[model samples]
Target: MFLLVLLQVLQPAGAQFCPDLCVCSGGAAELRSVQCGGAGMSALPVNVPPDTVKLRLERTLISRVPRAAFYNLSELRFLWLSYNSVTSVHPSSFVNLKALRELRLDGNLLTSFPWEGLRDMPRLQTLGLNNNRLSSLPAHAALFLPNITYLDLSSNRLTILPAELLDLWFPLPELQKGPVRRKILGLHDNPWLCDCQLSMLTSLSSSLGSPVVLMDQLLMCSRSMAPSGMLLTRAELSRCTRPSVQPAATRVVSPLGSNVILRCDASGYPTPTLTWIRTSAYTDCCQQNLLQNSEQPPRILESFMQGSPRVGVRWSIITLNGLSYQDAGEYRCQARNMAGTSEAPIKLKVMGVTRLSRFPKRKPKKTPFKSSPKFRKPNQTLPEKESPFIFPPLKNKIQKV
Candidate 1:
């Protein structure tokens, strides 16, 4: 009875299982390891031993993965489905593979990702989603697989990190508990925006005490360099990805109006946080009350003339209203997040509309009044203004008058 039960437990699904034509090996392996990769496989075989430990199906022509394909594989651990033409992964696929650990899905044409499918593998650690067309990593990605230490998400079309993804472990509260640390976050090949949206990534790199590795180097800017050129190196991406810092030199541009924006721009790791502090708080205290849009304004101002906040490639805008000379002073914009803090000083110079007196007015010189040609009468007889001319033409012409 014990020998019969052991044979039943070791048996694969279905009776007299024959290796499919898609797999190169003819199921001749007496053990569990199988090498079925690159045999023109369009779909997973219908019958295979549940105890198969290593399954290699890479570089095949498989397009769609069927649901319930990998169920009851209690012993399957390492699965390589990379370098295929897979477009979509059904959510029900890989639902029961509780022992799956390392899965590689790189170099595929996958446009949409099945987050639900991968999350089913609770014990998953290393996930490779590199070289795809994923634009955004959905929120709570880290939460689904908390044990994931090696994540490779390089070479995607992502313009910016998701807004809620302030940190790698932002979604998982336990991971954000300050003492926790991740081994690696492979975010290189993706087109990352070098703006404040990526401040968290930049700031975390400094705290990590090393440069965040992209594919070939560190970070590749989405907009900084040529598209087809070599990947950005660690040094080139250092300043670009670091959180913004305050500039030592301050510049003040005072414009005309009751409302003015004290513009602050600087560079550092973890993009600088902006906070406007009126140095002459008591003197221009009334003006502070007049400041409009006190509530958090949209991140960027649309008006071309208005100031914009400086992030990786651009600037951030802050508005101030009811300007006075007292409003002019050192106003600090403090930028802070989990990584670090950066304070940029904006020396406010309130430039109101130039009063006529304030502007040097030309003095109205007393012009000698000249009689108008229309109003003047011709002189009829100029009698003895001087002695009448005696000789008419002494040297040249005879007097015709």
Candidate 2:
């Protein structure tokens, strides 16, 4: 077998010395390329060949590349910077690479990118963003990706494809007015939540829209586990739904003056806001005083934003303190969002206790006369009805000294 080699010519100026710990080679005459992978350099090397066509810098320590890093390389085409510590990128980093075609940015920590920066490159075709930590796409991501024929977003933390993306990519004239192109989209290995809105991707047809070739076998549900592991194409998203209050278990019988924590977990699109409301009409835990007319109806005992992605996950916690006889009633946790409102009831039963002590007891004193009420001793145990001691319950989680 005969091997073909591209001729390499070295110009006399600064082209003779290659960048430290990097291998640079290509034709200096018409087509040039630079191979600088695994250099262990922390910054973009200075003085790259001006006529470099292809540049590879995989597995390097380069953390970031500012706007003017590759400003001079007008003939640059293919660029690879995968497996690096690149956390950010300036909008104008590729402003001068007009002849660029393919761009690779896999295995990085880019949560978001500048979308308007793509207006500079009119000839862009392919883009790879796999193996990254992207949770959500920008709303206007479609405007910047109109000309893309191939896109890869696999192995990321994406749950739902935004409605904006679905309407813009398909060829339907009513949804979006643009020249529709048959594109190959890679979205495997993502924590894709099969929301009902995602049905648009799998339901595209050639008559009214361009044929979308979604890899359904590889598109398994991530958050809500299934037994058969159905594909996205066959999974009826409308049928594939669950209530906001999953499992729907909330009821506690905490003792009087005892602190109790009521859990309210919700799951829905656009994340739900959790709030606790006392069902009784008379009072609530947040009521400052019984005599105040403008008490504002207790202002919801507690409220918190459930920490989770806007998909099938969990909600927040609510701690009710110093349970009293009045607090023994129905408490409902309401979760409301743009989708709708759902509530879970917590029936609390608070039992009264006159006294309870964990302190060391004292010995009884000798009663000389039996006429008196039997000379009560400190060591004597008080029955449920006879004890006169009543202590305030704890306010917070920690015990007060």
Candidate 3:
């Protein structure tokens, strides 16, 4: 009895630390790795051994990561939660992962990440966020992930990236130094807008002694007047250009009490801001003279603007509601950027109201119907059709030996 009890105590300490539905591997005294997966897991496993160095929990139904989820796993070096349905993670979910070097959340449903949480993982080097639904990142995201050497952001809905982040990867001449290891940045398969910003990335990538490696895939951008699949390395994007406006129509005619939408699209590097100004000449001499003054500005009309940096395009629309004679004027869409400013004019003319007549509803006349002789009834039985190229049955010829 004493011998059996001693054997049970000496069996394995790592096995006892394993959480339910998880498999652990390590020496007899400590657990180093724990892996938990399958459709049955709906939440993160608790009570992971404090000494565990690696943990993988993938392909589960885990939708959210609660705060301090891994508070005790201080020695963890790698944590992968790929292919999960995780949509959100609390800012403090990675609280105690100080020694962590690699963290992967690929193939998740995350639309936004808590970049502030990176403070907890100070020693992290490799970060994987590929195959997610992220469309944008905060401007200051580069501050927290400064030391990251291997970054994966491919296959996301990213259209534009902050210049600060790009600067981090491709430092200025004065800031560049001999890196301990070559940095790898994966940015392909994104809808990058071909602007001066993207042009800077391409130019940096082509530098003779750059330390960063953009994966071996051509980065493409969406641009007006360009082919559907244009590569970013084109010479057109090599330099910054002034902003230019493309108006849908130069003149608009609308009836009184009706609404009309005037659209203006602008393109340039350093994405431009569009403004709508009501520049119609005023009747009062003082006002007209003031408007003519170069220093004086016209009245700015209320408008809606949307910009897609990924496509290097910004558009603005102003709606003239309840068009009246007083609303007739020339509106100017002024697009301004660091490069230069450009304007496009739209002239609106409102005419007297003309009433439209409503036609009365008419019902169809009922008529007696007869079936065509060529049409067959649903329940009618037809003669059997012969099969084409039918083979005849062979007779069994017995050969007497």
**Model 3: lowest-lDDT 10 consecutive positions:** 392-401
Tens digits of per-residue lDDT for model 3, 227-317? 5579877637655655789999999977778999999999986678889998874333223323344334578977765656554578988
lDDT of 1 at 381: 34
How should the candidates be ordered by TM-score, best one leading?
Answer: 3, 2, 1
The best-first sequence of candidates by lDDT reads 3, 2, 1
TM-score, one value per model: 0.50, 0.53, 0.56
For each candidate, the alpha-carbon lDDT, in order, equals 0.58, 0.66, 0.77
Which digits, one per residue and each the tens of the lDDT, describe model 1 over residues 1-401?
Answer: 35534565667654433345533332335536655656457777655555567677777788888887777466778887888888888878887888888888888888877777776788888888898888877765645656676778888777666544454544335445555544466787677655544544645555644424323335666574334333443323344443464433476645545676545454554444445554432224334544443343323323222232454423455566666654555656655533444455656665544345566789756444443454334752323332334322321234432
Candidate 1 stretches greater than 4 Å from native: 1-18, 21-31, 170-179, 199-203, 206-216, 224-401
Tens digits of lDDT, candidate 2, 1-401:
01111111334553454566677775656566677766468888666667788888888888887985677677888888898888888888888878889888898888766677777677788888888888887768888887878788888888877655665566446545555677767787877776554554655532254545544336767655332456766665534222377424556776768997767778765566677787653234433343244334544676543466556556676666887666666678777653345677777776555456589889655433222234344454445453233222222213544
State how far residue 195 of model 3 sits from its true place (Å): 1.2
Each candidate: RMSD: 20.0, 20.0, 30.4
Error of 1 at 297 (Å): 23
